[model samples]
Target chain A: MYTESNEKKLDEIISHYPVKRSAILPALYIAQDEHGHVTDDDIRYLAKRLDMRVNEVEEVVTFYSMYSRKPIGKYKLQVCRTLSCMLQGAEQITEHISHKLGCEIGGTTPDGKFTLQEVECLGYCDLAPCLQVNFDYHEKISTESVDQLIDSLK
Target chain B: MTKVLTSRFDLKGEACDIDVYLKTGGYQALAKSLKELKPEQVLDEVKKSALRGRGGAGFPTGMKWSFVPKESKRPKYVVCNADESEPGTGKDRDLMRYDPHQLIEGMVIAAYCLNAKDNYIYIRGEYWYIKEILEKAIAQAYERGYLGKNVLGSGFECNLYVHPGAGAYICGEETALLESLEGKRGHPRLKPPFPAVVGLYGGPTVVNNVETLAAVPWIIINGGEAYKALGTEKSGGTKMFTVSGHVARPGNYEVPMGYPLMKLINEDCGGIPGGRKLKAVIPGGSSVPIITAEESEKVNMDYESVGTVGSMLGSGGVIVMDETTDIFETTRNVTHFYKHESCGWCTPCREGTRWLYKVFERMHRYEGRPGDVELLDDLADKILGKSFCPLGDAAAMPVQSAIKKFREDFDRRIKHTLVQINKAAD
Candidate 1:
């Protein structure tokens, strides 16, 4: 279960649409936030609630990068590895985050506080080499800021 | 006094500045409507305003919102279709770049009216800049308590998140967008559980368009009646028409939706940059059928009107072709994009887009068999409605229409490709 504030907000958030399918993404977001990341059971719950075929829901949730199917660490670091971000040295930043976290590109840290994933385009070309941690987007990040942001998250 | 729609929400120096957005009239509409307007009243205004979805479909915004029954007890959603990967379409990118607040305001107001709290803008991966702009705006909205629980003490709390999509043309489709938003490959599902009925983690949803959401705050602030006064009957409000290809002024232009297509290409857009003879016009992106120069006088920037002129106003991405450009080659380029971007979710779109480009490529290379034109038409028709998504239609429409409208040009191009090659060899 999530915090009361999250639960209350999530319920109200889910009620805004007419169809149950609309709530899947939000529910997933909340579930991910609460349980660190999503699980098969969470998706199953989402499918049953939204009236979607479980297979249908699974295919979609698995396709997009934003939705984490597995439970991730506390700090879900999604570094932009698309064209613009890559042009700005996202590869180097990815390595730095990997080095700092002592994990692989898609691996989480030992303490389970940080999970690094190479995501496609965070849509911050102006401040290239961007990484979004939960709701906070750290823009124009260098290797040092990555460590600082990661350190602060822990 | 009324101020500009999207002034402060654009670029600040090189970064997307939330502080600048607050310095201006950003979030003012949500702030004002916190305690005043009920959800129905806002929906009613949108219904009255008759604002159509700006994301090509042109469905009525209020009607689409009303489709979600209020008593369902189902958690609802608001997904902004910002996946503008259409080749000629650049309007949404500009809107997000220049005035992200308009979209944020629109989404916030739409969420309030639709009785939904969570919203996501499924943006194109290529628009990394827009992601920065929108996320900052949402964060600012949260900081100001415009978002979060008990919004503005009105008990109309809503949370917003920015979800960017990999550049898949299919993802622009609402259902496909839901799939992509769910972290799946951007492939559309069969409708009827239409995304509004089943979307985003399988919840009752209202997947509104980016341009459509950006118009909401304006509709709410100015009153739907006032908003209705902007453009023509049915097709109201100013539209962002992106004109590319052989035009001198190849960029996004905001004119009334009812503005004459010729005038847009001529006056507002500074007609054909080099004064070259006009060949053809894809009046509304590559999805719509290409309009010939002869039919140039008839086109206007709207849904129904463009169809009357033997083409559709799909996304208002006007691509102008000059005399120097070959219709066969132009189509080859367009079809190739569709082919490359097809998600292979549906066979018709997957096969059809590939066949379309391949046939055009053959015709372009002067390697067409005798009945290639007829074959092109037949192939286009075969894939027309057989696919799961409109992408099949998007792939087939222009190719079939272009050949129908200008078969002679294709014929001539084949002759030129073949005969000219032989002549050069001699």
Candidate 2:
């Protein structure tokens, strides 16, 4: 079910740890990257691969906010809503993005092009009102800049 | 002004590149330690430096390293807690992104002291770009023979790897970090079998913060006394504070410990933008107590001085708030963060944070009852020291202190709700 390069990559990751079970996080990342999100089958497959119970793997997936069980939009717009960002007008930025996308905080667009999420601190509080499109950071963002960003992405 | 940890931040991204790092005296400490110093001697130097961990809890770094058993048969491990998830903190992100080799050299020196062969940097998953930069730097370190088998022809083997954590703030805690490293839920384990004695695949391990470990290379090069002389006696060495919110220049500033808090915000950060009055400051991250502007005037940027103002110098986040900010709304926002980040290991934290947020939400919407403020206080009191982990205390401290220092904000919501109820009765 894995590509040859991906499978080789997983093996290389597994080699970094002393025990095979310790590679579950990296392994899950690989699975999520291959498939848009991790599915039940992927969890079961990983369980067998890492010698862990299916529930164990499932628990790890659910525990972390990064791992998405369901498929996500092409661009995940995770706006930082913690104190620093909020102090710097993150609420307005979030509101503007939501209005522009025609989606709520947790919902995806009809076109499946974007998903809006109000994430806690992104550790870029120095650049208040920052966000991430997928894994890339957009720092010191403004409403107009967010409009430009969405337009550019579209 | 002492730029111990962040001297290379001005290099304009060249510090991440190894050639620049080496030219700027990056791995000199590792070379010096490998050639001349014994493992015990290295530990003694760190002890003399009086360096404290920059990761929220201000434990001494050398004391933490001494906890690992010297003769344990199990393979020793050195793990760097790069999971910089504390709200209002972003210093570690810059440290890793700007100077990856500095962290690498520090970890190698730590491993040498512990006689550990394998080390890992468990960075947060959202920091994937920084992780990529760190990986490239590690590859460069390997290429230069600073890492891998036979370091500097000393026959001591050291291997460093970067491990990414899926998004979980609880993983920043040492035991939880170890649990996450072991590929499980990031639930924190109990104390007594601290990670120092029993950690990382059942081996004696030493977990240090990114800033804490990054300071090691300098401590070794400049002599422990010199490093200790940079700061106050109790809290040695300079610290990196991510000063954000309402400031003209919001960025990380490296200053000696016990530097004046107001000076950091007013001078280094260029004060509040547009001459707005300062309302309050969360001197540490959001987890610490909120100090009023009156209280902030006397506070200094150190562990004890912040403690004197009923807050901690936690993670050196220094979240500044201007007069325009609504304390009620800000408190609600902080409560929501804990509510979401709580790992649900203990009932008080799990249920207590949820209850606090519900109350804060109602108060924020102006539907608060008269006793709601007291109830919020009572709920926070229940959860303060009664949880399985410090997450409970982290959630409760800010809410508790916010209520104490800024009671007017909470009372304002309650008063508005009372007026509406009286109008309905009339």
Question: Which candidate number would show the highest TM-score if scored against the true structure?
Answer: 2
Ten contiguous residues minimizing lDDT sum, candidate 2 chain B = B415-424
Q: Which pairs of residues collide in model 2?
A: none
C-alpha lDDT (0 to 100) for residue B351 of candidate 2: 99
lDDT of each: 0.72, 0.93
Judging by DockQ against the true structure, name the best candidate. 2
lDDT of 1: 0.72
Question: For this target, which candidate reaches the highest lDDT against the unseen true structure?
Answer: 2
Residues A13-35, candidate 2, lDDT per residue (tens digit)?
Answer: 98999889999999999999988
User: Residue A114's C-alpha lDDT in candidate 2?
Assistant: 94
Candidate 1: count the clashes.
Answer: 26
Kindly list the per-residue Cα lDDT of model 1 for residues A36-113, writing each as its tens digit.
Answer: 667777777767766888887787666545667776787778886643344346779999878877899888888788
lDDT of 1 at B314: 73
Per-residue CA lDDT of model 2 for B52-81, tens digit only, reads: 999989999999999998899799999999
In model 2, chain B matches the true chain B with a TM-score of: 0.97
